[model samples]
Target chain A: TQLLEQSPQFLSIQEGENLTVYCNSSSVFSSLQWYRQEPGEGPVLLVTVVTGGEVKKLKRLTFQFGDARKDSSLHITAAQPGDTGLYLCAGVATGNQFYFGTGTSLTVIP
Target chain B: DARVTQTPRHKVTEMGQEVTMRCQPILGHNTVFWYRQTMMQGLELLAYFRNRAPLDDSGMPKDRFSAEMPDATLATLKIQPSEPRDSAVYFCASGLVRGVGTDTQYFGPGTRLTVL
Candidate 1:
């Protein structure tokens, strides 16, 4: 079984702060995806990184895939109240199976 | 925007009861998945189907848990003799690809089940 371990299970920070969440695993993945889920709703896809050492940016969010494809990170800059949500990282292996991360709940207060 | 739809947003039932959750995938999606979420376990994939065929169900308990896709648009997850530990949010997601590679999944609101 493959497992993705996420760091900083809970995070609280004031507005304008910068934060980075990490997800690591021992197994290799064909693709990695980042999602943000608000309360009372299912997760929404933020980005998908398929290549090693890949970097993608969406406004204030920057996502990176590890050089070895065993890790990924999501960095948020100038966090605001709108950035608060549960962030999840999922890895897709050779099979159709997806392994989800431990999840990181972020709260940005104004 | 097309999205996955799940029925029975919330359900409360006693132990040993039979519980069923249904999902309607997006119009063109061919893959459907069921996941259980809890504080301790995070999100676990119970089962997934592709083109109305079972792909993998290793994460599901064979005795009490059953997942099936009756058609390309409908998928169901059933639990017989449900236990207290089954109280969690069950999510149904669908995607456009068969599996693997870069298929993006769209998730439904999820059905929250409480077994007492």
Candidate 2:
């Protein structure tokens, strides 16, 4: 049973502040994905990082995969009120099984 | 934009009752998954199907939980003699997995079930 742990389970910051969330696992995964889920809605895919040391940017959000594929990070630049939501990292292991992180609930105060 | 659909957005049932949740996968998708979300456990995959076949269900409680994909478009998760602890939001996702880990699953709105 593979497990993914996320840091800062709850985050509350003022608008325009920058924040970073981390996801770590002991097991190596084939790929990792970041998702943002708002209230009353299912999670929406943010970005998928496949290779080690890969980095993908989606506007103000930047994602990075660990060199060993055992960890990942999401960094939001100049965060705004609309960027507040639950941030989750999902790692895909062998056999197509996905292990989700504990989740980080972010609140950007305006 | 094609999206997965689920029925009974909200359900409140008494304990020991049978609860059934349904999902309709997006068109052209062969992979389907069922997940349960709670504050404690976050999001846990209960079961998944590939090409309308059950692939893995080890995450689900075998004693009282059952999941089946009757057809390409529909998947169902049922719980018999439901308990209060079973309250959670159940989500259904569909994807087209081509390689080892290239699939991007699209999730449904989820069914919020509260067992009393």
lDDT of 1 at B88: 97
Chain B alone vs. reference chain B, TM-score for every model: 0.96, 0.97
Candidate 1 local lDDT, residue B36: 96
For model 2 chain B, where is the 10-residue window of minimal lDDT? Answer: B96-105
- The interface root-mean-square deviation of each model, in the order shown, is 0.7, 0.7
Residue pairs in collision within model 2: none
lDDT of 1 by residue, B1-116 (tens): 78899999999999999999999999988889999999999999999888888899999999999998878889999999899999999999998885446898899999999999
What's the C-alpha lDDT at position A21 in model 1? 99
Q: Model 1, range A51-71, lDDT digits (tens) per residue? A: 999999999999999999999
DockQ of each: 0.89, 0.83
Cα TM-score per model: 0.97, 0.98
* Candidate 2 C-alpha lDDT tens digits along B31-80: 99999999989999999899999999999999999999888989999999
Question: Which CAPRI tier for candidate 1?
Answer: high
Clashes of each: 0, 0
